[model samples]
Target: MYSSGPKLYHVHNCDTRQILEDYFSGNQEMVFEEDFLKFPIRNCVTTFKLGHIKGDILIDLSISSMIHHLYAACEFFKHIIVLKVNDRCILELKRWVDTRTGAFHWGHVTKLHAEIDEKSYEFQDKEGKVRSAMQHVVKCNLEKENMTEPIDLPPADCIISAWLLDVICKDKDDYIKYLRKFLKLLKPGGHLILVGSLEVTYFKIHKEKFHCFTYDEKFVREVLVGEGFKIDNCNVSRRTVESDLIDHKGVIFIAAHKE
Candidate 1:
């Protein structure tokens, strides 16, 4: 079993609704909007639309616990498997998928995606596509050799890990180890889409603080190459909205293929 540590965000007790409201909602700055929403959606849609990134099954390993980024993938992939750190996240996601009461609204994200694609009339269609494409929401233990346990999942054709390793890993070694573990979940030559917060060491969820592994663009490129991944494309977007809420300098997006 994975043991909890001090200075960690307890996933079990994390308030998904509050998280969505505080960071993801429109009231706050556009940091999350640009880094998480616009950039990922643009790249995913562009690549997939151009017949570059094609896949059957896509695995999401993002800690954000939102399906905003998956909207683009739904257009290309038939099935999507979302791996969460805890049952709470899984349940929260399922609530939205099932359209249950008190489910967090993702219409803003959907609309933004629609605007970017110039398909304003198809935003509802995009939402439905993501909802229907999601096939599983399984719990993940990053510290373990097998991240997804009690469920032998098939190898994925593409993996999307957004701000997950930096938050969960304690050090560089742990990050590398976790990266290797994540690689095992993908088929050979499969695509790996990563979104990381650059030069960040900490972030807060409500009152609790969590640690982030400090890294730069050079480190990310070197690490990915060293771990047998061929860099396909990488881009970094500098943070425009600064706040004491988070210490990130920028957000980095990388698209790679296993070598």
Candidate 2:
């Protein structure tokens, strides 16, 4: 059997409360919040083994604060292509990926901007370039727009998303319609790995209460099968506490292959 190397991770029943309780006592890697140790899932993609280490990723879209997911993808995939639909996350991911003076994505690779829009809003620090370029992201995205298309780079081996499918199709019926647009971006036989939260992230900013929903793993499978993607694997990270550091706590992880 080929062993999962020390770099790869597989944490079953992975919960935050239990991990955090352990962390507060001493450890630093794990944390707790939604009130439990194991977290919950909406849907799950199968397990993905790094068959070939090619480092290109696409994140679909993200908010300014969700840049961490991009970093995590870089760390998890070994090689990644982070596709950002939002101006803020793209700016932050590019400005901070390297130079060793900014917020590093997941402690591994720092994504440098292959290209950035010159017309987007930009902010510099009154404190004289504080932390790093990513610190200026909030200022940059205020006027950001999706006026351009992502240039076609060399083929990528994997694609990833976090909590995106939940928003695509809430009732399962509309899921495929929303997802078909994204599937066209992937190269055939490439993989799509996703990790998403089960909680609403807007409680702190909006005047609305959020609803809890499952990602409908069955629907995810149906959509993938219909799209001609070969089944690879699927798994869920248990329900756990949400984090104020980022946003929600409950999460799910899934991996699939394109045929």
Report the number of the highest-TM-score candidate: 1
lDDT, model 1: 0.80
List the candidates' TM-scores in order: 0.92, 0.51
- Where does candidate 2 stray beyond 4 Å? 1-79, 98-150, 153-155, 167-174, 198-214, 242-250
Tens-digit lDDT track of model 1 for 122-195: 97677788889996888888767787777788999999988888777878897898888888999988999998
Candidate 1: clashing pairs of residues: none
- Listed per model in order, the count of residue pairs whose N, CA or C atoms clash below 3 Å is 0, 32
In order, candidate lDDTs are 0.80, 0.38
Candidate 2 overall lDDT versus native: 0.38
What's the lDDT for residue 54 in model 1?
A: 71
Candidate 2's displacement at residue 177, Å, is 2.9
Error of 1 at 172 (Å): 0.8
Query: Residue-wise lDDT of candidate 2 within 191-218, one digit each (tens)?
Result: 7665554443322112222222345456
| Candidate 2 lDDT for residue 199 | 43
